[model samples]
Target: MKVVVQVKLTPSPEVATALEATLRSCNDAANWLSLRAQDREEDRDRTRKALQSFAYAELKARGLSAQPALHVIRKVADAYSTRKANLKAGNYGRKDSKRYQRIADNPVRFRADAAQSYDDRCLSWQYDAGTVSIWTTAGRIRGVPFVGLPGAVKTLAEYRRGETDLVHRDGIWCLIATCEVPAADLNTEPDGFLGVDLGIANIATTSDEGEPFAGEKLNKYRRRQIRIRAELQARGTRSAKRKLKKRACREARHATHINHVISKRIVAAAERTGRGIGLEDLTGIRERVRFAKPQRVALHSWAFAQLAAFVKYKAARAGVPFVQVDPAYTSQMCSWCGHTEKANRPTQELFACRSCGVVAHADHNAARNIAVRAEHVWAAVNQPHAADTSGAPAASAAPQGSRS
Candidate 1:
């Protein structure tokens, strides 16, 4: 498994200047390559090679490294490839086509790649000494102080040193180290599954034991931020604009931290019980559902996608199976009797099935359905031929209840 651990760096004035120069040079090189590649669209390899050879001596004279320049070329190539793919997919007719066209016309901005540009030969970390030696434009910066080395990061350092990204954000320099860890002994034949229903009211509800993870706190915080942002924007002053930017960053960090915590607990719960985790496949949900203006804003701002991504990575690291089932009727269908009806979910919180006369919390009902769906999927894939004496798939025996 690959994971990134970010450690804060404290660099001297001279070292900071060198780092900034190196990043600027890399960005310039990337922009140059992007423009050249567009002109020689039919001959990508030739253009890249020619640009590399031409920029090598010039970049070296500017105290920049060769690896970073090459990395920039790769980044530009990837961007162009993505644009071409989108164009071929007929996305050129979309509103974002103008944005794509602008990219084609201008130089691509190069974001610093801490790992790709890192000269392994020139970079070294002394974990016990709390220092890192890195290559920079002005020369080698030795014994740069780094703080807050998490226990997990220390373990990864012991195993192997991978690529690290040096990012400069909001006047802070941080090193993001990507490390590879050994895979866990996954329960391939998981006894069952823990279903998780993601939403705005209840962030996550599992099929197994424990109360729902409430999102009220987060929702209230987000709404407060929204109101503050609106008030600041109304002023349209320099200070308000600056405060808005800072507020945006603060909100993002807070939400991200919450997602990490939620995902970690959910994955841990499944691992503890030796069961897999199941989730709804909510791709393109925004396009599928319609809502009023206020509700639309809430739905649009909801971090469902971010939550799902966090859960996926955490589950993978723990060797827990994560299954995503179609979410079409998972919310409306009765989890007890498999009865499908829109009337079953008359309210947002309550689910009362007409066919089975079963009553349960809507989110809990949906989570149970997700769990059963995952079981059915797992059985179909792993035990295709395994059947009970009644000649039915073993998955049919899955418990049909809201709390399952």
Candidate 2:
């Protein structure tokens, strides 16, 4: 199992200025490369190499002497490639335009000082406990202590696997680590199964077999963000822009902290239940329909994917099962009668099956339906192959319909 531990970096003001300057240089180099590439005279790899070399020279001139991280150049190139591809595909949506704008404003990133050894190119030095330490702060943090990284490693195996990514935020940097654990098969399993419903309003509603966990703190933080953003939007000055950026960082940091807490809670619940988790296969919810303005923003902010990812790996570590069930009608179907219809979801927070007269809280009803689906899947998986008449079970045989 792999777990990540992040520690804040405390850099002197001078160091911060140097780091910011290097980032600006990187962005400038990337912009130049993009403009030069328009001529089609240089290959993509050549352009990327040239940009990296330019970034290196820029830092050296500033007395930093840091080597440019290839990842930085690759990311800029990828952004440019994406823009070209989208233009060719004619996906000229506002969202795509906003993505282009984001890429254009990012700063240049370097691996380490150019004077450092090849192995130490990306690592920064930290003064702590009356000693100097080295750490890789390329992706994470402006400055952070290096000694904290090794303590978070779950195993030597993970270190050998080399799946750590460093990230920077709030003028500090830290390591993000990934570890692989064995997965459970919920379809052909012996243990019980858990069904979970994710949503913007409630965050997550699980089968009665399991308890529900909501991101209330996150919601509170989001509300604060709204007020801050509104206040910023009302201002018109350079100071206002600075304030807006600061507000944005505050919102992001708060959201990230909440996400980590939520992840830990869900994982702990799964471990307590000793059952494989069954979640909705919500791979394309956003693409399928349009929502109201506030609703759309809420849906996008829920972070369902991050929740799934956290549960998956945590379940693996705990030797619990984790699987995804078809989500198409899970919420609209009646848990009692299996009758699926939009009318069953009679209100925002209520589910009333028109046919069966089954009524319940909307989220609770959906959670129950999900649990039933998981149960059926469990039964099918446990049944003997001799009992199976078809290569795969028929969809009609599976429970169908949802209300909300």
Q: TM-scores of the models, in the given order? A: 0.87, 0.68
State each model's C-alpha RMSD to the native: 3.7, 6.8
The per-model lDDT (C-alpha) reads 0.74, 0.57
For candidate 2, what is the TM-score?
0.68
Which candidate gets the maximum lDDT versus the true structure?
1
lDDT of each residue in 1-404, candidate 1, tens digit only: 76667788899887888878767767766666666665664645434566676666765665556666566656666766776677667666654678656754654455653223464665778887888998776777889988864775575466555566778877778877767767677678887888899876778888764678856777788789888989999999999999998988887788788888889999999998899998988899889988778777777766789999989888887889888877767888777677788999889888888776777888988888888788877777778786222211233334444541
Query: In model 1, which runs have C-alpha deviations exceeding 4 angstroms?
Result: 41-47, 90-100, 111-116, 159-161, 387-404
Whole-model alpha-carbon lDDT for candidate 1: 0.74
Tens digit per residue, CA lDDT, model 2, 171-214: 56444434343444433352555667888777777765343565
